[model samples]
Target: MKHILRTSMLVILIIILAACANDEATSNEEGNKDEGADEELKIFTTVYPLQYFTKQIAGDQASVESILPPGSDPHTYEPTTKEMVEIAEADAFIYNGAGLEPYAKQISDSIKSEDIKILEAAKGIDLEAHVHNHEEEGNEEGAHEGHNHGDQDPHVWLDPISSVQLAEHIKETLVELNPEQEEAFTKNFEELKGELEILDQEFHSQLEDLPQNKFIVSHAAYGYWEQAYGIEQIAVSGLSPTNEPSQKELENIIEKAEKHNLNHVFFEQNVTPKVAEVVRKEIGAETLRLHNVAVLTEEDIKNEETYLSLMKHNLEQLTKALSNSKSGDSSESEEQSDSDHGHSHGGDEEAQKIYDGYFEDSQVKDRPLSDWEGDWQSVYPYHEDGTLDEVYTHNAEDSEDMTAEEYKEYYEKGYKTDVDRIVIDGATVTFYKDGEEKFGEYTSDGYEILAYEVGNRGVRYIFKLKEEKEGLPQYIQFSDHSIDPTDADHYHLYWGDDREALLDEVTHWPTYYPSDRSGDEIVHAMMQH
Candidate 1:
């Protein structure tokens, strides 16, 4: 009887100990869960770029998510009740403002909690005006049904420069929310800004010299590219992909395509290509895909595509379309004759018009020497100091046929300059060479257009020295890729006693930029070539 009682008491004690151990384990796990929730911020964004940028800047300090699911159009997407609740519960809500998300303002206003921080990515941006195809024809019904964003274009993130602004806004908001992670956020933001500037340089260099500048698109999302890179987008639809063109508008688009010799029609990933297909069939043109980077498709997500990869892909497609050969082959004699004519007379009238309007409007009036008035420094010193080596490498990487050494050598010659600095104050021009200053008063001589062997032309704005000064060239010519009068951001100058000789010398055109820019800034500017 004594042994039985002892065994039963021992078994009861063991059961109580086991229960206490299990309870302790559960309590510890719950505490860890609460601690983790407090350590990391929960951020919700409206689009893919914002989500990607937030993740990039926030690193492990925050958990970033997009309310829009994969392949969903932000233009038409309306969050469900559950999603709204989820967003309201987050620590911050970031959105691409300027009417990109029609429901974003509504959700933000309805949120009564002070815990959630709201950020508009394009808060201070000057948005481009959204022009509809039907707006010119007095089709109010169609215009209102298609586009709802009054006059402002909400797709500001399409341009890499504008994207930098968006990322900066996001970084500012994140720092405001979590000041403890400010250092990490700042480092990440700077890295992101550098990447974006490099991307911008790539776009500028690759697209600047293309023979064809106009491209047709199903939607007008690429207007920012036109504003930034000077490539014209002939959008068949309006601001929104759903904005279909009228019959007359369609005819006009086809006519413009034929006029510009456009061979490809660009279609977006998320939008259906029915109308685009109609236009393509009508024109018998090929099709290309241009991802807007607004949302990621299932395939894109599976392939792990980011904004950089998507943009590089878009660049490839653009190069292919722009450099596409004309419809048919020509005989050897015909080709030779055409080449000769192009060299002699700058190609046809259409080509001349296109070249004139390549960077700016052809109707720009003749500019004065005051346009070039600025304190300038030669880019040759930066090249010699190896500051521009990265730009050369980038050019080589993007080139299909050139090697790195070859590009470096080519730029070395192009940037060679003896004159180190120049200062243009009103009509007085001072050239600084070898620690000596040569001053001369210059007056504007009429501009001259010169045709290149490549079938393109450039305008040389000539400035004649009014009075002869020691060590001063008789005439100075300025070419900044502008046909009409505008303040030159930078310029390629040629000077000598003979005016005609300077015009013929095109191989060694030394480049110059503002004197205040740092080596990195000068390198960044040169990458835009």
Candidate 2:
């Protein structure tokens, strides 16, 4: 009986020990799950639009923040050491690029960790050139040169269509960082895209038939608007708000405002320069606020303002300004004088061209195959023989951020070609490759506008072969960055048997130049690009 009692006690002890071990194991598993739940992605952005877009897409999967403080000027703002460290430790850093934030590229280069992704929201988007009026006659050479944004305008977020691209990039990056939540991210992006499309339609429907399309603003930050909509912006300042106009330029601006009968002078929410005030006073116009959306004020944040809200507000203000009748009475002779001036608007012929080409449906005109009639040579060989090394170096220098090797690598993918030469005469295209030639009789197949994944768009002037040939491609397309019918100086060519598939080929452009030009001339031309 004593032996049996001892055995029973030993069995009880073993059961208790097993229960304790099982409890400990379960606790550890729960702890690990809680820790994983706490590890949300930390993303840092340089501007408001990127921050907003990231947050909208990330949902509960990440935390989004901006290094740029509210109401701070991105043109002159620099990140503090703490902010830099935070950004370096983040899962990703997104910036607008195109010289919007001068320090962003440097910060990106300094962070060498493979753990983080540095993304440019404006990358691959074809930025519009900033047309400065300060270079005009009678203006001082150094006038309005305080903030230089190079040649390309960086405020691409204002346009709804472009904002969709920005949001798409942000979504892609988020999906890359945390692919487990891809369904949520994709759903969020689709909803956001729908809203943006609706906003774009609203802009078109509301602003299309307005009596006046011109409005005066504090700065030339609305180039996209001028391009997307048929509206004209008479800016009192240069691209940057700090780039105030010269006295002569100011006088010209005031004259143009008066001539246009503009009753409102638009100023930015963050920046309201004295020059803008003076212009408003000179023209006897009411002052209206336009948000750049680069930075939002505290009030804007408190009121829950978003890119869509601000854009809608802008549309409202524009409607009021553009639809309003002449603010003050003017003599019949003054009206006649305005008529005589005939929309010159201080001789901004380039601005007029943008207005003319605003509507894409009306912009592209059909053309014949003669537009590409030239003896062309591929730029690929030049790249291979190191003849284009200097050109690549020049491009890197102008890039303001990328190294020569990086730029060269980037171009290598874009300039790769199997064909060495192409001769287009009349409707016949001759392709020379590997010591053999293929000829095809091609006819115009119209043009198609392609929206690239990068957010920019291109026009492909396509041609179809009349008859199928054994060695020749059935379809050939040319893209020279021109929407209207024009002769090509140099062109990027795509050829395949499937016309629809050829249109979807965004990679491997295989660029060509005039065969008659010397290698140095070709290099110079590429450098100019």
TM-score of 2: 0.55
Write model 2 residue lDDT over 140-209, tens digit each, in one string. 4423322567788899998889989999998999888888888999999999999989999998888988
Q: What TM-score, computed on C-alpha atoms, does each candidate reach?
A: 0.56, 0.55
Please give the distance, in angstroms, between residue 265's alpha carbon in candidate 2 and its true position after superposition.
0.2
lDDT of each residue in 367-449, candidate 1, tens digit only? 77756766899988988888888876876776666787776687688779889999875466888999988887788887877
Tell me how candidate 1 scores on lDDT. Answer: 0.74
Candidate 1 least-lDDT 10 residues:
331-340
For candidate 2, what is the lDDT? 0.74
For model 1 the local lDDT of residue 74 reads 88
Q: Kindly provide the TM-score of model 1 when superposed on the true structure, using C-alpha atoms.
A: 0.56
